[model samples]
Target: MMMHRQYLIDQAIIARNILRVALPLQRLRASATRPTLPETPTRFAIIAGDVTDPSSSLGDLAMFSALMQSLRAQNPDSIFTIIGERRHTIVVPGIGETPVEPAWAGKTGTLAFDELIRQHHALFVMGADILDGKYGAALVQRIVAYCNHSVLLGIPATMLGFSFNRNPRAPAVHALSRLHPHVTVNIRDQPSLDRFTRIVGVLAQLCADSAFLMPSATDPITEPEAWIASMRQEGRTPVGINLNAHALAPAIAEVGMDQLIDHFAEQFKRAGEQNGLAFMLLPHDLKSQSGDVSMLQALDQALQRKGFTHVRYASIDQPDKIKRLIGLLDLAITGRMHLVIASLGSGTPTLSITYQDKFEGLYQHFELSLEHTITPMQCLTDELLRKINDAFMHRHDNRARILSHLPRVKALASQNLAIATCGHTD
Candidate 1:
């Protein structure tokens, strides 16, 4: 049934794309004839919003950096700019910094929103938190209204399959769509594109998650043998676990911190005991003050009560370091979408404790059975345990299946980039 629905969705998108192309040619041609502005070399701006938070994983940053490299290689004249929060001093390699405008101050600085839009040829908006509430839609609309030649690469929360409510600021998005037709909006998943199109009356092109296209290493981490030896010496299995305790204001109504911590801790205990794996609590977003310290403390206490002595916790601040930790994992189970993507992309077997639709899309894209991945909020304990055990038993096969799908996802990303830049396949 899921396959059939996906097929129908794909067909609908293709049909919409055809209509969008055929219908817009005349309008585009008329706009094109007005004046051929002299082609200045293209400059790409990655408007990351916040880049220094502990919650921002290294894998995600690496993938975005890789995208910048690809763009620079394709167009050597292109320069890349990163507009980030004032406190975030951490930088992605190959990206130049531009300070982000404070929300309350309302756009005044050396790099004013209007001036930034006028200077850059393309824009890539990469973070998940940026799209919460109507901010994402409003931001895109603002860019479209002021910058005629720019594209907004949005990673909408709806990509994870959560519904996007029409907030009070939605009218701003609609207004911009009506006022500036040249601004292209691209989303990470199909459902988000569908929702955005339904609301704004402009078809949004679908693109695969950029994380999947990240370059894999033949040997990404150093001294793997030493790490493995240390684990063996300690009589531990070195299992990696990523628990997302942080919730943006928007996510609280859907799931709370206490429930999330309890759910993960319980699952970790069960999986560790059954599989002989020691728990390594991996915190993906350390900057959000989600009470990770308390959560870890709680898990440690739970492990002691259960008579499990092999447990450790690690927090990472750099993307390369995160990649190394992921490489060290014999197996990983995660709630964060990017963690699962990183593990799978790195050839590590993973079980996704799903909280959204993006997880389902990723599993489906890899042709993995949905039965193996659990939605903790919805599943019973018995069901969750059964799935975990099944994942362990079939980890090898599932890892192979996921690796096979990476090329297709990468190809899709490349194809989308071509279409977005040139309006046709390269």
Candidate 2:
């Protein structure tokens, strides 16, 4: 059944790719003339990861927040605008809710998108796996088109901090290959760098995820903070656990959601009983269906049934708060990539449940071992239990390893911004 569903998705992607190439839109062609930078303050048109969604993943929000904050810090006088649906309002981390300009006034063509780009000095696309087409072909196609339009208009454009899997869509590679030299493509990890270069036949630049630059909350909130403090007082190590349903969909399909939940619950129960560790449920996504909240609730209920009161839910409203709280943990076991970033970037030990083959490259950035990551299939067995206890037992060493390589990793993340702006400060 899963294979059939995937086959249909692949067919849809192929159909869309054929149509995109066959029916080319007007003003979407390359231009021989190039435009120079303006003497006045630059206007940046941002293509954020998730700006308009109400139930946005805190990870996506964090990446967007970090990017915007970094840009503002570098160019304080520059004007910024997010290209998104005007109907939806976006709430950034430090800066509250913000309004956005519509990507299209009417039709889905280059005329309107180009007119929008012509108003800005440059275009910045936050490439957080959205360009891969495996997630959504239409989104990847639209962003690619926008980038092509921007570069053709003589404006600097960049697809920053992105990754590609082993088998990327051919259309995405083709589209990326045809981009103007004015447009820069920055791959987030080394594996993705090699994969992209091998497929596209272009030497794409390597960088780290933008979320690594996000600052943790200074004024900590209560609840989880107080709860973690209480656990420390009792001589227990606080461990943050994040399990997202979106990443585990394959595993859920293979077995069942309940069975998978039960498996994790049993393992966590054993870990708590044997190790005397306090657990915190840290949820990143708030979507009703595929979000982490439901899975977190299920785990909480299951553990509650087993009379495990040592476990508590982590506060997850703001990215900074959750990031700050995650930093307080002795260690973390997470499925979401952003959670792993937040954990490791904070110098906290993390054991990740990796998907998409992306984590291996991320761990490579930190000079950590692949043993730090496990697959969804491994979650069903004793491997997860063994890794959890093992990670906790060697928490200090893992923390040291993460901290040792954090400086270089952060410098790589900051490089994404410099490349995106074409080395222009103003």
**Which candidate has the top score in lDDT?**
2
Model 2 C-alpha lDDT versus the unseen true structure? 0.77
Cα deviation in Å at residue 5, candidate 2? 13
Which portions of model 2 show Cα errors greater than 4 Å? 1-37, 50-55, 104-109, 419-426
Please tell me which predicted candidate would have the highest TM-score against the true structure: 2
TM-score of each: 0.70, 0.90
lDDT of 1 at 378: 43
* Per-residue lDDT of model 2, residues 43-141, tens digit only: 777886653553277877787678777877777776667777554567878656655776632244345455567678878887877777666655665
Task: Report the lDDT tens digits of candidate 1 across residue range 1-426.
Answer: 986885575455434423432233324434432222224536655555343342255545665655665666678776755554343444554554423432111233222433454455555555343342343333433333323323221111111111233341343444435523334444555555565567656545565666655554434444443555577687667767665453222233356655545555576678778887776666665554644445666667777766776676665554445555675666777766767766776766777776534565566667778776766554334565676677788878877887788788666555334413322110
Question: Against the unseen true structure, what C-alpha lDDT does each candidate score?
Answer: 0.52, 0.77
